[model samples]
Target chain A: MTEADEENGPDSGHDEIRSLVKGAFRGQQEDRVDVLAGVQAKIYDRSGGKFFSDGWSTSRTPPISTYLVTSWVMLLILAALYCVLAPISGEPKRVPTYPAPVRVIPATQ
Target chain B: MMRGLSVTVTEADDERRFLRRLQARDEHAFNELVQLYEGRVYRLVLRILGKPDEAEDMAQDVFVAVFRSVDKFRGDSKLSTWIYKIAINLCKNRGRYWSRRPSEAAEDLGDVEEKGWLEEGPARTTAELSAPDQHVQGYQVEEIVRRCIQELGPDYRDVVVLRDVEELRYEEIVEITGLPEGTVKSRLHRGRALLKARVSRLLGEKIE
Candidate 1:
């Protein structure tokens, strides 16, 4: 036990070291400024817009395409599963597509 | 146990989906990733490289590598773990580059050091720095810690920073370093001892 302690390993209670280590994290939040813009700029320049084609790479805001693509894919998959399984469960006549909204033309307008 | 495992599997699936987005270069996914990891990468690089400006550039380089090659990520370990591996690897590479061109690296970084940083901070002595007025002396202690951490050999510094400073798990450290578990343990032990000796010397204490 004494030998291990002498080594000052993780088992040792060196709170001072731990406390001081926070120094690494200390600095202006400005110093720790967001690198996303820099990273995007680099990737865009390096790849010649192979990545920045849509300007999303340079945009700080999260791209809408991310959520849209995932939602659309998942929705399509679920709809397909429901449509395929509907027939197996004796519901083939059910349609997956929503009926188009009725165009109620104003009568004799 | 079963519930825990299902939760774990679900998390893995979620990560896989996220990884796919990153691989596909989904703009929002990439943005989210940079925001999520920029702080951590900055901290690790700052501690390793020993300068805020250099750390920022290094951190940027790390994310660039991550985005470019994210498709190659095999998911053998967690995505964050893979990112740490990249950060540490880049730090090592930059460290080597600096050492190879001492005149240039020193000239550039020395200027940063001279302009209101550790070597110029108040509280000259460790004892004075350790006084109860943390708010007053905090900067000095922080600078001292940074210098001491930088002073150690890279082998020792990496383990010390990852284990003591970052407080990562042994297994995770092992993954980041790709060092054997036993080697990690031994190096961590020796690193801590060396750090303690440095601190003791700073305090002008006699330690066997």
Candidate 2:
């Protein structure tokens, strides 16, 4: 035995008490297993069929598919908005440009 | 050295797999975790609360919390250590709740016969006793020890239970309790000394 072990060797009194404590609570209760199942079921129900989904992943970030779908949908929406708001360009509109203002000042020789 | 490194790598890989399975809400993985930890959690809570029903409920609550927050576990510590922290926190909360309502803290010790361990007697030593007599004697001593443990303050009792009963390492105790290592050692020493003295007096025997 190590020196430390010898120094803190078991005492009869302590051993007796320790044994008593162990004996008092020896067996594992069976109901705790049932409790575990019940809690798992509760968690499953609360998660609402999303327990196995990517939302519950360790990183808990949105899935790539979600981001991809969202980006595509946004692009489609923006294209639709542009189509609705922008005027149909059949031909170039007539230029209504006026002549540049003639600023003819006296030439200083 | 290579073998040790391999063992470490294997353990890390296993832990990673377990965490992935848990986060994926694998029923088998959840069941395996529960089976591994439920007894220890229940026993720890029972030691703290001293009520079987409450301990059972708290044990369930601990696992439920773990299940709900499995995605948040970052694998910084052993899973058992995290579970122990949850159990300890729940026990502390329940103890505080009971303390707030003094009426609920009253326990009946009368169910066990009050045979003073310190009483002067020519009783047979445990070694000399028959098997049945030894069993009875052990039961009586256990009852006394349980009462003594219940009488200890929550701080002392928690340290004592984690150290003596659960047989956790000092570092693990520190992690679970969030106490400094020095404080954990001191509490454990004081708690053991106190139990030794009390049990010695009760048994009419020297502890050291």
Candidate 3:
């Protein structure tokens, strides 16, 4: 260990370094992050997605056409399933599409 | 021989598993790896480049590269070890690019000026700045440490920071630096001595 290190334990050394690093980070955050973000944004534009664009890219994936399509498909399937599995209100009976023939009209004629 | 082969296989398996998780885009695993080594990578880049912004960019770049090429990870050794190797190579490339950069020094000078940072001028006497209060002296010690580190040769500085400041194990240092063990040890020793002298100078200790 250096004489300075001997005077100060490794922990102190670490503390000092950590403070400097924190200061650096603070400086970066305050002054440079916008520029950095812009650069990263440009990179994203060029690459067609953000860095780490796979599943890990963003906290939440942005809404896209595919997302809407998937949601619609899922909703349709779910609605169909609900219709099929839900309890019926009454006994199942086919409603007549055409009225029982109006033979009364023919008898009057 | 069989044990050695098995060891290699085990290392490879671990790497393969990590890469597989990465391929599945595992953020937790990625963050785990970053948490494991970001300090070492940051210190390495900072010491090598002598610029914080560049170091941050490089650090991010290293991970981005890892993410891009995760599929190609052969997993012959430990994951950390392999990542360090790639980081060092990237640092070297960055170093080479920097050495060829004609405008970087001027740009850095501008950066310092814009930040209103003042360098220690030779005309200013240290005694004039020393305060009567003892608490200030403690703060001065930390500044001394920073300046002492800034003065060491890059090779020595890097190893010193990696070993003493970052506290990385010798084997990891070797894997990251691609230096032989003896070279690493020698660099650390020399670095410590140089650092000691500089700090002693800061403290006004006589060389006796």
Q: Write the per-residue lDDT of candidate 3 for residues B10-102, one digit (tens) a residue.
A: 877776787788777675566556655666566655655557788778877776666667767765556766676677678768766766887
Per-model DockQ = 0.21, 0.13, 0.08
Model 3, range A1-109, lDDT digits (tens) per residue? Answer: 5667546643343433334323222222222221223333444555577453543333233447677899999999999988887766556888869767765555553
**Consecutive 10-residue window with the lowest summed lDDT within model 3 chain A:** A26-35
* DockQ, candidate 3, vs. native dimer: 0.08
lDDT of 2 by residue, B1-208 (tens): 9999999999989989999999987766877788788877887888777778888888888988898788999988888988998888878887788778857555444433354433443223343346885656655655556667777777888887887778788779899999997677666666666776665566666655
The TM-scores of all predictions, comma-separated, are 0.70, 0.66, 0.52
- Which segments of candidate 3 are over 4 A away from where they belong? A1-56, A60-109, B1-16, B23-40, B43-51, B102-135, B206-208
DockQ result, candidate 1: 0.21
Q: B1-208 in candidate 1: lDDT tens per residue?
A: 9999999999999999999988888878988899988988898888888777888889999999998889899999999999999999888888788778744433332343355333323323233355555444555445555777787888989988888767789999999999998788878777767776774455344233
In candidate 3, list every pair of residues with a backbone clash: none
Instruction: Encode model 2's per-residue lDDT on A1-109: one tens digit a residue.
Output: 2355346742223564555455445532333434565565556677785553334332223367877899999999999988876766545789899999999899899
Ranking by DockQ: 1, 2, 3
Q: Name the candidate, 1 or 3, with the larger lDDT value.
A: 1
Q: What C-alpha lDDT, on a 0 to 100 scale, does residue B121 get in candidate 1?
A: 35
Query: Which lDDT tens digits does candidate 1 get at residues A1-109?
Result: 2466656745566655555555434553235567887888888889987775565457787478887999999999999999998888893576589888999888895
Which numbered prediction scores highest in lDDT against the true structure?
1
**TM-score ranking of the models:** 1, 2, 3
Candidate 3 residue B42 C-alpha distance from true site, Å: 3.9
TM-score of chain A of each: 0.37, 0.34, 0.27
Query: What level of docking quality does candidate 1 show?
Result: incorrect
